[model samples]
Target: MILAPYYFNEKTNLSEQPYRNQKRRLEGRSIRDLPLYSQELLDRIRLPAERDLNDDPCWLRTYYDPSSEDSWGQIQDYIDTKIGGPVTVYNDSSLYNFGSNWEKIFLRAPQLLDNTCLFEEYEEYVEEALEEGIESESGDAQHAGENGYDPVEDENPWICFYSEYLFRLAAGHIYIVDEKTLASEGPDAGTVLVMWYDECGRAIRYYREEAMHAAEIANLAPCYLKDYACWDNAEIGESYEWGAPLGPPYGENRREASE
Candidate 1:
């Protein structure tokens, strides 16, 4: 769908550390108190699992900003030209279902088709994995007993509700490109590049420091898709129980049953 341009205004502040502000907004809330969205939607928009991007070789964290009023106008123009054409923009509130992580434009292209084109359409498969992490100091202090050990206090409690955010095309025609790599090579390496594209995909007319005026890089690959197989061979067994047969159906040994 074409997002209403009215929603794109000066008030919109794009930040790389989106989670920091969102966590602050929901400082004391529990998972039960969080807003609701389909698990499918969360799977599409949520950030990559720690196992995916945490150790990936291509992973780089950077930010980009439009330098001047003229630059902002150019970016806006680019988005405007793509709408109301054969191209479709897959932008719905569904993309921003994860609390305030997404700053969606309120009034844009609503005429476009509202379908699963935003990302690859996949059948629903719910798999639950338990995540463990070290406890924060505050958590340790909160439940710490005078005794030497506190089972609850010994480890920090955290819940990984969903897997990492995989980059999906909005209606198989649009993409939000992270131009940090290009910006790093340009004049302002510290700034991040957050550019939205149309059916032309990855083609953005923006100022690259190496160039005098705005330039366009078309047909950029979608690197946001992670390869899950990287850690699949690590032999991390399916269960916490020791030597309990290697795969799923952890309860009884089939061989023992046959005997």
Candidate 2:
């Protein structure tokens, strides 16, 4: 969903962590207390009811600021702390460059998908590529073919070709979340959270699977759908589960069941 841009009323003050403070302020408050932009985003996401919040792993939310230099590091730290090791970051398709590169990387190293790797390998590859003046452009692969260099023949095609994108993933430049992996692996394997942010980088939200997970990261409780103004309008039949339809079931299966 296309979310409206959100801007902070106050000026940017890096002296203190403004985003951290904002996250703290949002805790324990009704969704009604949230700014209109935040409320609108939450409404579009359609959170579950308060009664199901604890039982439903999909209803949790967290907070983080991508604009902050330290925020990515903290996210990595959180994932590491949860999993006891570094995670193989997966980017949303919305992250065009990272997503495309990830597809290529997966083709070359399918075993690495959703698996941890030594951070040193990513770092070393990046340093060597930079020293060699290897262009990260998409056209570079085509150019290499003309020069008699075939990347497919390489033992480590991911390292030989898309190492730059791998570096970005390891460095946390791209946002990463995979729901299925999180579900199968459990929180100890690492929890993934969806993030939303305004174009101006003034506001950010982390949609998590547990309130404690969110609170631990933001150091504050998260706002819930119960606090939203539209919560009262939610239909009794609405499942509020992630990826579930908003209304009564009406697919072919429903017809067959009724018959």
* Tens digits of per-residue lDDT for model 2, 186-259: 55224443332221221122233342353233322212332332121222211212223311121222333335
Give the runs in model 2 whose Cα sits over 4 Å from its true position.
1-66, 91-247, 250-253, 256-259
Q: Candidate 1: which stretches are off by over 4 Å?
A: 1-67, 73-106, 110-115, 118-218, 221-259
Q: What lDDT is obtained when candidate 2 is compared to the true structure? A: 0.31
TM-scores of all predicted structures: 0.21, 0.21
- Give candidate 1's whole-model lDDT: 0.25
- Model 2 error, position 75 (Å): 0.5
User: For model 2, where is the 10-residue window of minimal lDDT?
Assistant: 1-10
In Å, residue 179's CA in model 1 sits off its true spot by 17
lDDT of 1 by residue, 1-259 (tens): 1111111111122331233345458678654454566544544544333112111111112213443334434343543452322222222233422222212321122111122233322211111121111122223443234322345553411111111111221212122223432243555432223332222122111122211111122212334322222111112212211242222121222223334
Residue 84, model 1: lDDT of 28
Q: Largest lDDT belongs to which candidate?
A: 2
Tell me how far the alpha carbon of residue 53 in candidate 1 is from the true structure, in angstroms, after superposition. 31
